[model samples]
Target chain A: MSVLVVLEQRGGKWNRTSFEALAAGQKIGQALATPVTAAVLGSNIDSLATEAAAFDIQKVFAIDDAALEQYTPDGYAAALEQLIQASTPKVVVFPHTYQVRDYAPKLATRFRKSLVSDVVDLKTVSGGLSYVRQLFQGKLNADIPAEGDLQFVSIQAGAFRAAEPASATNPIEQFRVKLDPSAIRSKPEAPYREAQRSVDLGAAPVIVSVGRGIKEKENLPVVEALANALGAELAASRPICDNGWLPMERQVGSSGQTVSPKVYFAVGISGAIQHLVGMKGSKTVVAINKDENAPIFETADYGIVGDLFEVVPALVEEIQKTKA
Target chain B: MKIIVSVKQVPARDSSLRVDAQGKWLEEADLTYEMNEPDAYALEEALQLKEKLGGEVVVLCAGPQRAAQTIREALAKGADRAIHIEWEERAAPDALTTAQLLANAVKPESPDFILTGLQSDDLGYGQTGVVLAELLGFAHATIVMEVEPQGDAVRVKRELEDGWFQHVSLPLPVVLTIQSGIKKLRYATLMGIKKAKTKEVKTIPASQLGIDLNSGLVMERIYLPTRSKKTQIFSGEPKQAAHQLVEKLKFEARVI
Candidate 1:
């Protein structure tokens, strides 16, 4: 009869995407005429629960446990399983994040349910709901109908706006989970950053990014020449960085840096939803690829359906001439 | 150490897709298939571990009869043997059902560890590995970037968002979903291909697994994504299109 949105936080700082999940939950709750509740699991997360309570939800559950401080699949899943058993929410929503991807499926499986993951949109038909998620690396969209008594769904980033905080103050409850120390496997060490990020692509005015279309590591210079000519930072999709052709810090996608430069030149990159979500904020996106139906073209403002090898060099020369 | 690598066969990355007449799946005709890219990395990781530790590497795949091609590619790349769970359904089963079938197959091997791609290229569920681990009562980690075996446990480096990584330690009988590009994939050699043809491939029908195929979630329809923006395409010679793009960037968009 109610919707439960799980909010994720690390070291007591909210992962902004949690609000987007709240927004999605609120919309679903209104549509179904049900109450909406939220829960944040961590040690010393009372403030987080209070912050969430101000967001127009009916109640906030602060599930605190000393073992839940650092994220472990066993600890979080076990804790959430207990919470769901106690509350019995009809629908569960989460933000499709790396942390969620790690453990949400395991939690859902415990209840004989499968999570409809990375959902981009939702529709109500005949008083029932269907979730839309991308397939074939975002080449196609599949509509999955919502069935079963308990439904677990995760919303994609940027699919919903963050819920606005209101003056209404709701009740906050402290739910204690009995977690056994021995049951928690996978001891986690401190998280660390590799190779201090030297170039912040976020501040750049223009960025020229490459993808699998470049073909070989030897051909990278073709795109580098254009980046140099335009005075733009050179970035690349996950495959380029995974190949070690480009440094990991220069990668753009869900796991890498998210940039919003004024102009994003996607040279030979067929847009996967992972890469598209990172650079979709660019003011002007220009894509150069041989395939006209590449998903990059769907988000691009201007596109050239031709070989990047031939188009990039000519564009570099034109930009240099205009600068002169 | 005995490692079982779970792989999948998906349509080639460059294939043009058409919806099937039922609108429930892709058209099978005129489609080329290849080993799922992420699973290729998983196989490579397993092969490397086998080489270092001098144990067996087994590839486990679940698909239609065509999946045997992908299994051969894995064996050629250096797996000791393979297990194929023949599933001929047109529409893929949900993640939970797929994991249950895999768990039933993997239970007999009792491998020291299991490795699979973080997600498949086709369904992109990204949950089968973890769910498989749970069904088998094993500890698990996803997005694993590195793995080093200890006496009885393994230490793995897992990728977090925004370029952060955390090192985790788990005991044997664990499941680790490998991130793509963790290691370079080895191509199938003529000699290895010959050996692969002779290697053991045990085929088990899905019905023999005795797991229910009915999935809770149902695919209502499939279609191309709607365009969010109006893209003005310049189609012609490469030089002419480049010139037109520069003109638009300079004047119309004013980004330059």
Candidate 2:
């Protein structure tokens, strides 16, 4: 049985997580002792297909159609269903991206098959493969076993690192599938950057980020003072940005920007998985929150179990004194 | 116009999670339950649409009997009625099974629109909405941040990763998974709560849906995440800890 990896591309360039999914596909192929084929979908994606050909796999299947120029659940699902039906790969893999979240389920349902979404890891069990997925916002992980001959898996973004693909001089092939124009019931507009992003937090040497524990918006200056005292950039979790206390550009999380500042100070952030993936790469992480049991403590290098209102002011004063 | 909003009951955010004895689910003996956060947003979106378009808004849920409380909450928030699909205790159904059951429960309604949470706070599979759409054969969108109804189509704003947004127009009879914090949720007032007692909630047994409950994925194990780092806890007065933190930043981390 062969394995198939669905490569996601927009316009022409590949989505960032495509490589991650390919890496996962390679690993799964190795575990299952099967050859892996990566398929690129969309119209005029020859450049992408050429790029994917470099991967250390069998062949890159470029499935192109005019109806796929823009992403719509119905259009992509119908085309992919035809491809899967014809090829009949034992397993299909995808990167658990927003785009995949929109269409993978629809594609799986067309075949009456179950889809295992947002998996973090996979293990080779005695019988078959078991995938690990998180529950309760990362509090618990469940090992889910596949139930059918044909299965679908979506690897979470950042779950695997993209490896260097071996050069393939002749590994690119073109495949076509029919998509009914009348069946596509949605018209997509051009994607746009919601904000100009005045502040690029990823480049900052130090970042001071706050969360719901910071209390009211009026108290934001407390953390801002700490940021200023250390010459660090001001950032926040989703709630702070959602409340308009900080601009959307200042938000650091999955839906926001991913930052790897040198020294990251997370004041009162509970370290939800969505927020953790963005800042976990920081060189040094220090978290301060009144709740000692907050999940932030699990990842922080140094943790202070105290009120941010008191701890942040003292921190600012100490930093100012040290500079003086 | 008619709308069906799917909601779920989950452990409250503040509840401490403990692995059950079987190591396949949570120990919920004492945990408080509340409406899944994103599903509440979806219900609010449906209610707002009904208020604007002068249509009927019906709530649908699949869970244990305890979920009736969640259905009542949606009814209190102005859902005209509710349908609760009662499942066996501790039934760990995968996304497709759940979606199939929902599709079965939703067949008789044939509503113009269906709305659901982007994902549940508990399982977080985040695939039910799209699966339901495909099973029911409707145009669908996920992470919908805004919805504006046209005559026979709806223009929706969807949130993409990394602060990007997309606008799409989908024909009527569509499915949408609402993003959290889309709009302020309205509370159930005393009068509304009293009226909710009279609202209709029709409970259907999951076995009767004719969908195979055992035809989906199986959970082999569930456990707490292994800690990746050993945190050094700072112990002292708030000022003293802050002073030490600053010193460490200057010397150890050398960032400031």
Candidate 3:
């Protein structure tokens, strides 16, 4: 039995998480004692195929087709279905990306299987494989065992470190898929940014992010004052931006910007996995919330269980004094 | 512009969850429930589309009797009617099984559009809509932010990662999983709530759907996530805690 890792690329550039999926695939391959084969699909992906071949894998399949030049669930799923049928790999892995989410389920369903998505960890128990994923917004963890022979799994971003390329050069094979134009139902236009991102939160040294715990739009300045005192950019969770209190660009989470500031101050945020995945890379995390059980503290280096209204103002005052 | 919006009832966002004795699902005795957040947005989008294009909006939900409350909320907000597929099992089905059940109920309607939440709050399979589309031979899109009905098709804006957006046009009879917070939700008026009680709610047992219930994925166990980091908690008065935090940021973190 062999493992196939499907890598995602847009405009010839790989999604960084592709390597993470590769890393997870490598580990899984080792556990199962199977060879790992990587696949990249696009019109002209020879370079991508060669790049993937540099990794310590058995071989790379460059599934090239003109229909795949643009991503539609139909084209990608149909092509991958053909590849899977021909290769007959025991396992299929993806990076749990937006594009993968769009098509992987349908592809798995074609094989009479379900995709175990956003898997963060896996282990072999009694010679059977089991995958671990977050549930209830990361409050709980569930262990799901593989049921069928051909298991479909999508690795969560950051769950596994990206695999580095080795000196070994594997074989690159070109697999052409025959896709009919009429079968591609959805017509995809060019992807575009919504607006000129006014705030470059990624470059910010420090960010004071607010969440549902902040109460109301009127209460925003309580945290804004803290951001001002610390000379940090003001950011918020999805709900705050959804309420129009903050612009969509200022939102930081899975749907918004992913930031890795020098310091991240999470004020009244409960640290749902959605928000946690975005900011977990921050060098230093400080959480201030009334609920001591808030999941944000799990990722935080330092935490204070106090009302933000009381703690934030005092902290702002203390910071101003310290800076003075 | 006939539209079918699939929704699920989940524990209220603020309800603290507790694992049941079986360690397979949440304890349901004391939990309050509401319409799943993203599904609520899908219902809202369906209602808006019906209002503009003038067609029926049908609510399709699969859950226990408690799910009727959420169905009524959708009818109160503006769905023309609802189809309730009663699933009585305490253990939720996998995404494929759930989609098969939904597809069985949805096949008779032949709706121009089928909208579902991007993912459920509980299982979070995030694939029922796509799987349903595959089952019913309909085109599908996920993380849809906007939908506009064109002549015989629809134009939709889908959210990509990192603030990017892609516009796609799909022919009618498509399934679209809506993103959360795409549009503001509408509350039920007192009159609408009263009217909702009189509206038609067709109930069908999940077992009668004639679909296989066997799931491809099984949950072995469920438990609270173990804390990976030992967070340093500062316990004291708010002012003193703030002072301590400031000092730590300067000396320990060195960010400010």
Candidate 4:
């Protein structure tokens, strides 16, 4: 048995989700006694070939084509379907990303199989394999098996650990698949980055955020001072973002960016599941809310139940003193 | 233009959940079922689109008889009519199967566009929209926040990571998965609620809709989630404990 992870890249850059998929695949592959290999489809993916070796992957299959320059569901799905057929993998892993959402099921459908998607946990069941998927807006979880020998699965963002680059002398293979022009039904245009967001939070490691507790936009300076001291980016909750206290990009919620920062300090922000779904996987969660009963406290490793107006300044002073 | 919005009924978010003795899904006896939150957004988006673009909006639901309440709610909010594709509780097929069924059931109508929630509150598979697009061979996009009819093509804003957004234009006859909270959901008007009872609600079986569970995907089992919890305490004075807790948050939980 072998497992294949479809590593997704955009604009010639590997997405963080691909890393999450590799991490999930490594564990599942070990449990199933199958080696984990990654299949990447893009134009000149060889440029990013070194990036693939960081994961504890057994092998790397990189397919190159001009039609794959941009992300089109048909082009990528066709490429993956052909790649999977050659590998005959028992399980397919993907990040529950927008790209996967577009085509994973179609690829599964072509093989007469179905997908068990957005999984939060992967376990070795008594029979074969089972995965835990969250339901009811990140509340209940249910275990489901692939009904057959082959299964397709997508993991929730940040569900798996992207441990420090796994040290392995994993070999890379150039997988050249014959591409049928007809299979590529859609031609992708050049990827255009939306001009709205000034700061792309996808890559930020440290985020200092204030939420409803800050009261107004003027109070943002208090949190900004802390973020500046820590050399971290400043973000906010939905209410603050909605009220234009910060740019929409700084908002961490269902409607905003789904981030997994190394350190996320949420000040005066109530932890709604919608917000939690985006950043709960942060490496460190620290919350400061005036209301001790705030939901954010449940998820915070360190909870500060106090007024952000006073606590933030003190925290900023402490951090600045440390820096000095 | 005629558009179809696919809806699913799900337990209310935050509703306490439990598994029955059969190791199957819990009964919603004490719980209340509502039109899945994300789906309500889809219905709202479709209704708004129809209002502006001059078209008919049809709400499609696939579930038990009780799910008709959800459809009635949709109808009362101005869905021209409703389609009830009935199935047993256990018969709630996987995303691929449901997408196939939805494609076949709606193919006869040949709606110009189809919209559905990014994912359901119950299963949260988030696949049916994309699968249906593939099954019907329609150009598709998922997690759409903004949609504007641009001549024959539709311009859409796709929600992505870290406040990132993508603007893509797809030609008509497409499928889109609507994101929640993109637009305000509409409530049924008193007049519309009274008129919904008179609207046509067609009932069809999963089988009659050319959706055979035999050829479709099957499930092996469904069980409860496994959970294990542990607690750790820092022994010291209040101030020291607070410092230790912050340190743990940074080093251990990595959630600071």
What proportion of the real contacts between chains A and B does each prediction keep?
A: 0.88, 0.92, 0.90, 0.35
Q: Write the per-residue lDDT of candidate 3 for residues B147-202, one digit (tens) a residue.
A: 98897899999999888999999998999999989899999999999999999999
For DockQ, the strongest prediction is 1
Candidate 1 lDDT for residue A287: 96
Model 1 C-alpha lDDT per residue in residues A60-154, reported as the tens digit of each score: 99998999989999999999999999999989999999999999999999998999998888889888778899898888999998777799999
Q: List, for all models, the DockQ compared with the true complex.
A: 0.82, 0.73, 0.79, 0.32
Per-model B-chain TM-score:
0.97, 0.95, 0.96, 0.86
Candidate 3 lDDT score at position A165 = 96
Per-residue C-alpha lDDT of model 3 across residues A245-294, encoded as one tens digit per residue? 89999999888999999999999998877788789889999999887777
Q: How high is each candidate's interface RMSD, in Å?
A: 1.2, 2.0, 1.5, 6.0
Identify the runs in model 4 with alpha carbons over 4 angstroms from their true place.
A50-56, A163-171, A178-250, A253-274, A281-298, A302-324, B88-91, B210-256
- Summarize candidate 1's per-residue lDDT along B10-54 as a digit string, tens digits: 999988889888888888896899999988999999999988888
Task: Arrange candidates, best TM-score first.
Answer: 1, 3, 2, 4
Query: For candidate 2, what's the TM-score of chain A, rounded to 2 decimals?
Result: 0.91
Structure candidate 2, residue pairs in collision? none
| Residue A73 shift from truth in candidate 2, angstroms | 1.1
- Taking all chains together, each candidate's TM-score versus the true structure is 0.98, 0.95, 0.97, 0.79
lDDT of 1: 0.91
Q: Cα RMSDs of all predictions?
A: 1.3, 2.1, 1.5, 5.9
